[model samples]
Target: MKLITLLPILLCLFTVAAKAQDNNGSNPQEKKVLKLINALPEIIASNKLRMKKDPQRLLKAYIEFTPTAKDKYYQVSVCDDFADRLFAYYRFKVNAATYAIFYDDFENGKLVPLKVWQKHAYGIYSKR
Candidate 1:
């Protein structure tokens, strides 16, 4: 009787463990992209980076990620409007398990870094 009851409990535990391992088995590149997305708020707050549109408001915007030729870098494009007129591009870099984010704005047909943040051992650092 006790064994029958514990069988269901053990099966549940195994199911949960399998799900956890499945999540952990996700692609490393995807995980890094997710980490960049999740760190936006903290990075903005820590660096006092200013944006034309409110970051929270921009959360409703359409976002796309493009991987760079370099393995550890990516280009993130965010469109704040349904018409896609208002858009911005950002560069995200991963170094030594740390992340660095940069705003890339085009001027005179050349991309320029407007703001920058690099994750440090203690905290995030701004390199504006």
Candidate 2:
């Protein structure tokens, strides 16, 4: 296969592998997520990490993570994956349970409900 033809497949496989593992390192990428989470109260408090719409940082993160904008799961999943990556960086040493909780929350698709927002109350709600 031509290099171009193989690229997308490789990117998808890479993304899946990366998302599936826990690096738990103090890398710059991990640090940035930690910083962003720290800076955002509702996000950290609600377990709601989101990328800015049309974010330049997120564009770069997507390339870094393997772009799959056509897939909503990938778009947000990658960002959520990074936040878990950052949390694990600190958590692996002292609180691995947190990592597991995070994984379960994400895999279960525990998203905040639209109703919660419409009702002006933040609560745990999941599509699953």
lDDT of 2 by residue, 1-128 (tens): 69989999898977784343322324554444344333334444334323433222231112122113443221122233433342221110111223111211434444433234324333334333
Model 2 lDDT, residue 24, Cα: 33
Clashing pairs in 2: none
Highest-scoring model, TM-score:
1
Q: Could you give me the TM-score of model 1 versus the true structure?
A: 0.33
Which portions of model 1 show Cα errors greater than 4 Å? 1-26, 42-65, 68-72, 80-98, 108-128
Tell me the deviation in Å of residue 91 in model 2: 12
User: Highest lDDT: which candidate?
Assistant: 1
Model 1 residue 64 distance off true place after TM-score fit, in angstroms:
4.5
Model 1 residue 14 CA deviation (Å) reads: 44
TM-score of each: 0.33, 0.24
For all candidates in order, the CA lDDT equals 0.42, 0.32
